[model samples]
Target chain A: SAVISQKPSRDICQRGTSLTIQCQVDSQVTMMFWYRQQPGQSLTLIATANQGSEATYESGFVIDKFPISRPNLTFSTLTVSNMSPEDSSIYLCSVARDGTYEQYFGPGTRLTVT
Target chain B: QQPVQSPQAVILREGEDAVINCSSSKALYSVHWYRQKHGEAPVFLMILLKGGEQKGHDKISASFNEKKQQSSLYLTASQLSYSGTYFCGTETPGGSNYKLTFGKGTLLTVNP
Candidate 1:
């Protein structure tokens, strides 16, 4: 199992502002993913942050809107640019350890756009 | 595409049993189960790979029918701690096999 943590556990940001959430893992991981859970909705994948290269984003999510950076195997960051009320949701980061089939998640960063 | 989960919500008493089903239109290589409490991150439950496998952890178990592109999670003798939203993530045959496409989720409420 992997232990993951995210910064800015909860925040209230004004519309048009930006918030960057940081994810760190206790151990090195090959894959790290960012997800968003809206109110009364299931989790949606934002992008997969790779250690050295560009992140792979899912459809409906663009790199310009949700930029990601993974400088190393143990750390990554996601920036939600020009947020709107619709962007208000719980953002979570998950990591898949080197030899594990299961992916563990961080506590999550709850964002409320006002 | 996202998988579909049945019985959007369910209420159960302690020691009771419950089953949540997940189905997809596309062929699946694996099915992963996870549970998330209110305001908490999802926790991994179990993963059932292809070849029609059944995996279990503690009082929880899951079966994947690769041919049917469906999976079911069984919670036996459920405890209060079992109350949470359960999600089933499906992995397709190719392309980003490690990435999971999650279902809408089934909310399970266990009361003492």
Candidate 2:
């Protein structure tokens, strides 16, 4: 199991602004995942961040709107750029150690874009 | 495709039981169960990796039927702490994908 922590537990931002959320893991992981949960909705995978390689994004989510950076095995950052009211949601960082099926998640950052 | 969970919401009194079901149209390699309380991240409960497999932890158990591409979560003698939203995530038939498409979730409210 991995222990993860995300910065800015909750933030209220205005539209057109950008917010960068940082995720830190206690141990090295092969991959880190960014997920978004809209109000009263299920989690949607935003991207898969792998160290030294470009992040893999899911359909409907683009790098221009949500830029991801993985500088090392234990750290990653996701930036929600040009935010809008529709971007208001909870962002969670999750990590699963290689060879393990269980994923551990950090306390999510709740962003309300007004 | 995202899995579908039935009984969008359930209300139960403490000590009662509840079951949550998740089904998918695509073949699955694994099914993961998670419970999330308000204002918190979802916590992993268990994962079923094979057909007709059942796993349990302290009265909270789950079964996966690979043939049907469906899974069920059983919470027996539910406690107050069990009040939360439950989600089932399914991974398509590949370990390499590592991407899980989650269900809409089932909201379970346990009244005292």
Candidate 3:
């Protein structure tokens, strides 16, 4: 397991604005991911952030909507662009252990778009 | 595709036992179990890899039947702390690691 922390633990933003969530891991990790959990819903993977390459996003999630930046192995960011009321959800950052199958998740960023 | 979880909700009393089931329509390479409490991030409980050994910790255990594309999570001697939503994430063959298709969560409420 890894210690992960996300910045701006909680935020309320206007519908057409944007908010960037940051995730930092305790040490270098190879796999970092962003997920969204809507109220009363399961987690939806946004993208996979590799240290040196562009993120691989899942279907229905576009880079323009949720752009990701993985500057290094220990840090990454996710920007929810042109937010909407539907964008209100808990954004979580997770990391797969260096060699294990289990993943550790950050506390999460609670974003509420009005 | 997303897997299906049974008993969308279950209520258990302390010391009781509960079983949560997860099944996929497609073949799976692995199954992951996670528990999430309200207002908190989901925590990994364990991962069951295909052709690998079944896993358990203390009072919690799980099994995967690769042939059936199904997995079950068993909680023995339930505790109040076990009250939360449980999710099973499935990875099909050739799927990327850490990229899972999650099932609709099963709500487990363990009352003291």
**DockQ of all candidates, in order?**
0.86, 0.90, 0.86
Residue A8 in model 1: lDDT: 90
- What TM-score do all the candidates reach, one by one? 0.97, 0.96, 0.96
Candidate 1 regions off by >4 Å?
A: none
Lowest lDDT block of 10, candidate 2 chain A: A96-105
Give the lowest summed-lDDT range of ten residues in model 1 chain A.
A95-104
User: Model 3, which residues run further than 4 Å from truth?
Assistant: B96-98
- What pairs collide in candidate 3? none
Best candidate, DockQ = 2
Minimum summed lDDT over a 10-residue window in model 2 chain B is located at: B93-102
Q: True interface contacts reproduced by each model, as a fraction?
A: 0.73, 0.93, 0.83
Q: Residue B40 error for model 1, in Å?
A: 0.7
lDDT of 3 by residue, B2-48 (tens): 99998899999999999999999998888999999998889999999
Predicted candidate 2 versus true structure: per-residue lDDT over B1-112, tens digit per residue: 9999988999999999999999999998999999999888899999999999999999899999999999999999999999999999999965455888999999999999
Docking class of 3: high
Ranking by DockQ: 2, 3, 1
The interface root-mean-square deviation of each model, in the order shown, is 0.6, 0.6, 0.8
Candidate 1: pairs in clash: none
